[model samples]
Target: MKAKVFKYKSDGNTVVASYMELEPYAKNVYLSLSRKNEDGNEDDDCFHVVCRIENVYFSSGQYSRRFLKGEDCREEAATYCRNWIADTLQSAERGAFVNLISVRVFEALGLDTTSLVQAREEYKRIQEQKRREQKEKEAEERRVQEEQHQWLLNEQKRKFLDGERITGEMFLEITGRDGFDIHIRTKGTFNRHVRGIDRNGTVSFRKIKGCRTPDFTGCHKAVSAYLAFITEKEGK
Candidate 1:
């Protein structure tokens, strides 16, 4: 079942060119949202009548598709378009239908109206290059910060386990992403972002506080968990 296609000119008349149709898809294919027949063994997703405007040789524009047996969507579509045609014809005669999105205005607006699309392509390339540079810079900064902060966490863990004092070198190793390492350690590491300490004295752990419950329970185990986790990792 194809969709009912209608064309309306400046004259108050409509011509049926073609129509929308709904048909079943293959096993591998899924049905569209507004479909008549569902897909797969589950039968949830169904098929739909997708209508597209096609250009003929000289006359231009027709619509086509396969027909499904269930509903008369084409008739519904035709009815929907009928009102639009009536109003559009009235508007066109009064010349109240100026198109701001036309290529004429697009060209005037200094947008890329070139048939070659050279300017648009160049702009796209420049944007892509800029994105790549930004990503690389971000990644490089991330690497440096990770190395430094990991070092700080390691030192913290070292002090915690060895029962020693937090030292200055630990602070120097951790710096990046808006001093994230600092804020976290200050918060008291016990969260998801912080974990893992390398033997070379690189450490990372979230300085998460305890949960809100009776006795401020399940808190203050940040260092203990880190130590246990490190010990477990070392054993493995």
Candidate 2:
């Protein structure tokens, strides 16, 4: 037995269906449906259905090819395809045509659509899980950045307190700056840029509010007191 191929076209000429032959004596048929794109060109998407004559009769084979013998095989296959297009894909709505045909093919094969439904649910579940994972990863990164920033702040404060041992010359030389003013005003309070409390471009200093002695060394005590105040306030 030689295989045969048949093609069907819609009345609007936008869609085409093909009934392709399988192996000779296999008693199986392959149906392919395709539609043209907006520019009237055939798109790459194609939907397919495959079943054997015997299986069709055992299933929903009301118009099954089981009755067709010998020379009527090709004609029977074409007739079945026509009825399928008329009853199953009635509207010729190109967008949903593939989905419609899939339902019909499954019905014709007497197969339940539960697997398809479960597959879709599983896909959604996987996508949602991925979204949660991504969110958690972003949150973890933010926490790590915050921790690093806090650590840097604490380190800067610690060095500022250690500035008590630094001489004024050493401070100026190490900072690599010129024209820095360190002066004591009326009540012996010294106003000076605090060492190690550096902002990228802004000047930072500690005001020795209660100092009655004009000494730059008292600046470290003021910075330490400020640090303690900040820590206590933050905890509260």
Candidate 3:
């Protein structure tokens, strides 16, 4: 594809350029050239950029010297003609715009095409940067979700251990209810502790859940001391 740059008289301020491509197998692009001044009148010696800016034009069989208007460029637009415009590759060679208008005036237009390598390189760099940013965003989201899920699992584990110990404690308390009337019995007739194996290597712990129902509101340290006493004195 090839691109050209010029100012169109229809819209003077905007820099107008188009890309064009001529398919080798099909009809070649048609064009006609003319010269004119700023007053919209035909002249032989007008500004080259303004005078001969018409890139493509058509005729019945052979193109006469008649300079077609801008809108008449699409004499017979072809599929291959779409890629033959300026802006196809984002830029053209220096002075290419000036020569492009003259190129289409030929009958069998066999012209070399150009691609803007500089624009392609810049576009690739921008795509890589966007990919990096997207990866970082997804990683942060996954990390936050994992942390919250782990916290919930640990909380559930703590609750489960607490409830098991409290259940055992309540059972022991109820069994000793009827023996409250006995007096002056033995040295260690009733031991109210149980031992359980854990990753901390038989560490002492207290019942947590169901503590209020059994009226067993021992502080953490006091309950730990009770577990130590039971394991030592009761030989468990």
Candidate 4:
């Protein structure tokens, strides 16, 4: 089958990769080029490469089947491609990015990168677009995390106030009932702490857990209950 080459141009270097599908196995092959830029040029161009492959058929005979490795054919071809790209870059003279790519590499794969210059530009555009989308997504995530952090600080202070100004202990005392304080626990469920207080306050002190932003009221209930129990036990 005739192999197709996809080229992506950068500031200092360009990627010339190969893609092909061979039959009767119909296996897909990808050969990617990784070249380091020596010129240190600022890359303003980026893009993605998508190409159509021409089918390759093998004639059935003793000679044709003799060299075939069946399912391993694609892998073998890919390995050869990778080796050639690396070896060529290493041996190539240091100069321009275009000069770094050897003609022999393309000849070895029966493809040409020079002819796909226009296609390379399009591919670079696609790559740049994808990069922008990724950056936006990451920025949004960071913004959300910052907002969440601020909300946590505000909630912590809010739980401390109730006009008369309740401490973690006082909130539970007034709201607590039956000589028991409200207890709250968390296992990452319910965003905040579990909806309400557990007035029975039977949970072990070690079992009371909290996360970044525990429910404001829930925390008050839990802390008050523990403090109240402590006060009563002390005969205060």
> Which is the leading candidate under lDDT?
2
lDDT agreement of model 1 with the native: 0.39
Worst 10 residues of 2 by lDDT: 57-66
lDDT of each: 0.39, 0.41, 0.36, 0.41
Across 1-236, the per-residue lDDT of candidate 1 in tens digits comes to 33332333335244333344424332111123332333343243333323222321011122223432236745554443334324433444453432322223234334444432343455457778999999999999999998886776866656645655343334324222213233345334323333443323345444448943222112233334444555776799
Clashes of 2: 0
Candidate 3, residue 87: Cα displacement in angstroms equals: 3.0
Cα lDDT tens digits for candidate 3, 77-186: 33335444443333444322223232332222444443333344455567778899999999999999988766654553354335433323332342233132222121
**Model 4 lDDT tens row, 7-56:** 43455355454453322332334322232234543231211212223332
For candidate 3, the 10 contiguous residues with the lowest summed lDDT are: 181-190
* Model 2 / residue 162 / CA error / Å: 2.5
Task: Indicate the residue-level lDDT of 4 in model 4.
Answer: 45
User: Considering lDDT, where higher is better, how would the candidates rank from best to worst?
Assistant: 2, 4, 1, 3
Superposition TM-score, candidate 2 onto the true structure:
0.30
Q: What number of backbone clashes does candidate 4 have, counting pairs of residues 3 or more apart or in separate chains? A: 7
The 10 consecutive residues of candidate 4 with the worst lDDT sum are 57-66
TM-score, candidate 4, is 0.29
Query: Higher TM-score: candidate 2 or 4?
Result: 2
How well does model 2 score by local distance difference test?
0.41
Q: Residue 67 of model 3: what lDDT?
A: 31
